[model samples]
Target chain A: MCQLLGMNSKNPADIGFSFAGFRARGGLTDDHVDGFGIAYFEPTGLRLYCDNRAAMDSPLAELVSQTRVKADNTIVHIRKSDDQLLSNAHPFTREIWGEAWVFSHNGKMTIKDAADSDPIKQGKSRHYCPVGDTDSEFAFCYLLNQLKEQFEYKPDARTLYEFLTVQCRFLANYGLFNCLMSNGEWMLGYANTLLFHVTRQTPFGSAALIDVDVTMDFETVNETDDVMTVLATTPLTSDEDWQQLAVDECIIFAEGHMVYQDVPTRPVYLSIEEGLKIAKNA
Target chain B: MCQLLGMNSKNPADIGFSFAGFRARGGLTDDHVDGFGIAYFEPTGLRLYCDNRAAMDSPLAELVSQTRVKADNTIVHIRKSDDQLLSNAHPFTREIWGEAWVFSHNGKMTIKDAADSDPIKQGKSRHYCPVGDTDSEFAFCYLLNQLKEQFEYKPDARTLYEFLTVQCRFLANYGLFNCLMSNGEWMLGYANTLLFHVTRQTPFGSAALIDVDVTMDFETVNETDDVMTVLATTPLTSDEDWQQLAVDECIIFAEGHMVYQDVPTRPVYLSIEEGLKIAKNA
Candidate 1:
């Protein structure tokens, strides 16, 4: 399993404060430290920084945590891989409909079961391909290939949301499929077992990091209309009210606001340990 | 217009010494400083860094130059753009056949003529699309789209080389189309006007930079069998004998050695000044 961290903002914002706490999970506060990756979507294009090293010790990660690289959308993952290959790092990216799509997954997926069910899902028949030997990257490629086959270009928000809702549930049927995906315009999260989100807006107060001893006063940092929504595998702050997303739920956020959400038709909530045990046995 | 720098090595090698001089052209030594990007293909994956700010002034560039990010293949570009948007920076990248393809161009291209010629090249009918409004990115998309349309999988090296020769010549018909492209296995260079390369093998000697007052002894840094071939828009070193490629020529280098070279059946060598004037007036 891996840890995911994501941010969506109404205006351009930096993830420096949040990243400080998140980076600690990679061999410091937690043990998901095989490799790590982060992609920040700037107006110019995507700024992706990845390393096949523990984030706690990587000099590149240190540089990223200290720098104020601002973006409207950001996705980050610290990996605990079954195989710690450099190409197996999380936050795989590809271009779709002329836009860069970024994806990161946190749980094992039974890709063989899914591929056997549909001919289009097979490797040779698919339009997108994974460069690495990870189920996460294979699933990302499969998702984009399906989207490309279904739509000639970017579709309406509602149509896209609906299509993704069905696909997310289908993927979760195989195993835990918690993930975050974005194309710089909008970010979406799917929680099969464990996920959480928190929105910060006007009348903001102070928050203390769960991993480190640092505290940030949002009142001093944010503007009157500034809005930000952050998503993670677990809550990063000790004091804030972090809402746990329901099992099999899919939520999309654009410009720091919830644009669309879908509830599972047949919700079957499972514990994180339960999901891990099944994945391991399979 | 832009300045491109590429390195293909037999073994993992750093471009810090070469890039020190190359980065100087991004703002300090020359005026091609609209933006800059560099992609280094490591064993695990590719590390891509791009900045809209001038490389001389950008802190990111400073860190990149100071770091020893070694790779077997590397592509770098510094732009002098007609539009300075961040998305327009090169070198551009896409994934094809589960492999990452990196590309950079140093001249203007008349994409309108090419798209008008074939329905397959048309935007609505293409498999790949450009996110930025640049002829270079459009050309890269068109090339990849055509390849995907013709071949279901990655073709053999000979077939690919033959196909690219024809396509490279077709693209050069529109305007100046000097470029460098690689899929991490091999690097190819097309010279319609200005491109130069230098190969260094055993008995490596000292060299001096043309842009900055810096000199380095390659003998002290390289192993006995170290082999590297460096390509750039112009000669990077003042002391070395750089070979200028013929007009309409395409050369493919793999593992620091020239694997294939194609000469135009009807060569028309044009000066750099002439190519610039035609691009401006078009």
Candidate 2:
């Protein structure tokens, strides 16, 4: 399994504080260190930084932490690769309709099985293809292909939210599918297992990091109108109220607010024996 | 007009020395600083760093100068944007046949006129499209599209060179067309106006930058077996014997050696009056 961190803000804000704690999960606090990547959506283009080196030790990541680079939308991933090639690094990006769409995944899914059912493999994804050999990239390409096939051009936000929720649920059925995706404007987060999020606004306070000996006073840095929402596979802060998402849920956030969410409507119970078999196979 | 710098080496090598001088052209030594970008091809993937800020002032560029990140192939550009959007920054990248193709251009051409004749604008470029509005990007899309239509997948290097030379000559007829392109394994450079390159081998010596007061002792840093070829809009070093490319010349470099070169077969003479009219119209 890997780790993910995403931020969406009404005003551009730096992720240095949370990234410091989250990057520790790459090797220091916990062991998911195969590679790491981060994507920051600038006003007119995207800046992507990725390395096969452990984030805990990467000089580039250190520079990122030291510099207060701000962005309205950002996504970061620390990977423990099932596919150990450098090409398998997270936060893969593809261009669509003149905008860069970025995606990162946190859990494993069976590649052969997913590709067998992917629309991209069925000959619909003529324009975009993955340059890496990871199941995560395959799934991302499939998702983009689906979107391209469904819409003639960029669709409205509500329509996109409705379509993507169903797609995420379908992907979750195959295996663990926690993911975060963005296209500069909005962030879409989906959870099959573990995900947590926190929205900070006017009543900002000091927060302590869970993985490092660090604390930040948000009140000192943020303005009254500043709204920022951060999502992660695990909570990075110890003192903040982070809401844990239920399984098989998809949420959309824009301008630091939850614009849309889809919760599981019907609960399906599985036998313990069946769950054990699924876990064993995975 | 913008500036382009490219490096192709036998072994993975850091471009910090040449980059320091080239970056000076971004604002300090010259005034081409609207934006800047660099793309480094790692063993299995590509790392792209770009910023709309002036390279002389960008902290990211400063960090790049400090870090010794190495690659076998690298391309850098400092721009005075005809279209001042971050998306219009040089060194744009697109993926084809599971390989990332990077390109940067250093001249201006009429946009609407070029688009009218571009295959991409004619709707035949189904596989690749420009995400940015610059004429350079449109030409890149057209080039990639023509390549795709001619070859089903990645073509042999020599075949690609032969095809690209003809295509570039066609583009140059419209206006100035100087560019550098790479797909990790090889680099292709085309010059319609000004471009220079130097290949360094065993008996390396200290060289001073033309744009900065810095000097590098290649003997101290490089192995005897190391070979590197650096190409730029102009000579980056003061003492090196850089070879200037003739008009309508295209060269291919791989593993630090020039594998192919094409020079114009016949030169067309134009009257001074006609030349002035063309320049004025452009």
Candidate 3:
């Protein structure tokens, strides 16, 4: 399978330290080296890069290191392809609703490829559009179409929340729908199967990578005041607080907590941090 | 590798329409058929489910379809593995920081034997405990430890932000680290290489998928006013606007706009509705 990495912080910071140990696994010290892709959110827009070759040997990645493409939001993937085509490459980028969006899938779909295509709209409802042959992309298109059809050129937060829950019901039917998405800030993530995150805030300290012997201190990096969230298909570290999502559950991670969960008769008011705590306990 | 599926919206619409097409790809439709897992975020916490077999073949999944386990947040994954070892699975689950966090990876991470069997830390910044022998878990451990060290348990937002970015950077250096993570309400995504997403709010419209002959009338199914976001390794739809993220960029997707970034200087800020036009003209 492939690996996934994500980060969302309150401020701008570099991903160099984390990448140090992560990159070693991509065909160098380890071997996820089939192909790789990455997406970073800049203040202006997004910066993305993908390579079909071993990431360890990619000179382009070297340039990326030098450029130090900084971003508060980022996604990364290393592929061991089952699709083996350029179209199947990850950290897929596209233009949606006049805004650029980036996405990446960490698992495989179970469909048998009956030459699937976007559904045909039958009424005034908006239709979803697909861009590629990958099932992951098809799911994305279907979701977009559903959103458009449901709203019909309208926008509302409350209504949107309800709509999101409804669509998640459908995604539950898909194979593995574990994914990460970003429009720059406030990263959104969902787990039908598995997804883990570590949110660190206040009281800086020291840490180290398990696979590599590299280490860093938060005190040295910044003013000992930082807020960040890191997500992965699996827990990146064994020491932090990782949260697992529930079946058929849809969450909206805003600011830095799992805020806006839709439950029947449940208290609708809670902070992001509180919601996150509640999710862990549940 | 594995596949992931997720949905976010303002309404409680079921993903059945899109899910139908997506599920087919899980095993019966496509061939991502290694294993299947799903999770949904609810007001209390999250509802999660998983099967060690193809989603299409998993009776549990079929039951789920008919049960309608709904939530505002959702995540899904399908595995394609050649090994029977439980460690070689997708959508791994775990508990962290007093919360339950699940994860799944699609690519391979080669942390290797002895090195992969490190002890996990329960709040220890210097330790990693791997339940499985996958490189993905190792990376997760490293990240968690790094967060601990970076913040040193300060619990400050700024410090947390810097730590994640720095961690992402360090991880990328090892291998492809693209991933998806969430608690319930919002999502945090990064593109170490490749990832795609779309934020759907009011003004819902029509769309189509390039992989299947499916179409969704979001206007009809939705509450006419909704907001949502979708992310993937690639663009899911064809006729919609999907944006690409820059390398090393990380974002916090909240409500519907990017609230946080890793870049030094961001462009002009715009509302959910106005940002599109502003970004377009810029």
Candidate order, TM-score descending: 1, 2, 3
User: Which whole-number lDDT from 0 to 100 does residue A70 have in model 1?
Assistant: 86
Error of 2 at A42 (Å): 2.3
lDDT of 2 by residue, A185-265 (tens): 999999777778999998889899999999999999999999999999878998889987767888989999999988787
Model 3 C-alpha lDDT per residue in residues A162-237, reported as the tens digit of each score = 6766665566465556677765645667665566677766676667765567777767775445677777755555
Model 3, B209: alpha-carbon shift in Å? 45
| Lowest-sum lDDT 10-residue window in model 3 chain B | B119-128
- TM-scores for every candidate against the unseen true structure: 0.94, 0.90, 0.44
Instruction: For residues B1-282, write the lDDT of model 2, one tens digit per residue.
Output: 788899999999999999999999889998788888889987777888777878898777897899898899999999886555777887898877767889999787765564556543675335556776788887888787787777876788778889999889877876778899999888989987777899988899889999989999999999999999999988899899988777778998999999999977773433425433443444
Pairs that collide in candidate 1 are A44-B87
After the best TM-score superposition of candidate 2, give how far the Cα of residue A78 lies from its true spot, in angstroms.
0.9
- Candidate 1, residue B250: how far the Cα is off, in Å: 0.3
Model 2 chain A poorest ten-residue lDDT run: A267-276
Better of 2 and 3 by DockQ: 2
Chain A TM-score from candidate 3? 0.78
Error of 2 at A196 (Å): 1.2
Per residue, candidate 1 scores C-alpha lDDT tens digits across B151-239 of: 88899999999898877888787677989999988999999887889998889989999999999999999998999999988889999
- Tell me the native contact fraction for each prediction: 0.56, 0.49, 0.00
TM-score of 1: 0.94
lDDT of each: 0.85, 0.82, 0.56
Off by over 4 Å in 3: A28-30, A112-131, A152-154, A247-249, A261-282, B1-282
- Cα lDDT tens digits, model 3, B104-202, are 444444445323334332332233345445666566656655654544333554565566666665665654555555545445565554555677666
TM-score of the candidate numbered 3? 0.44
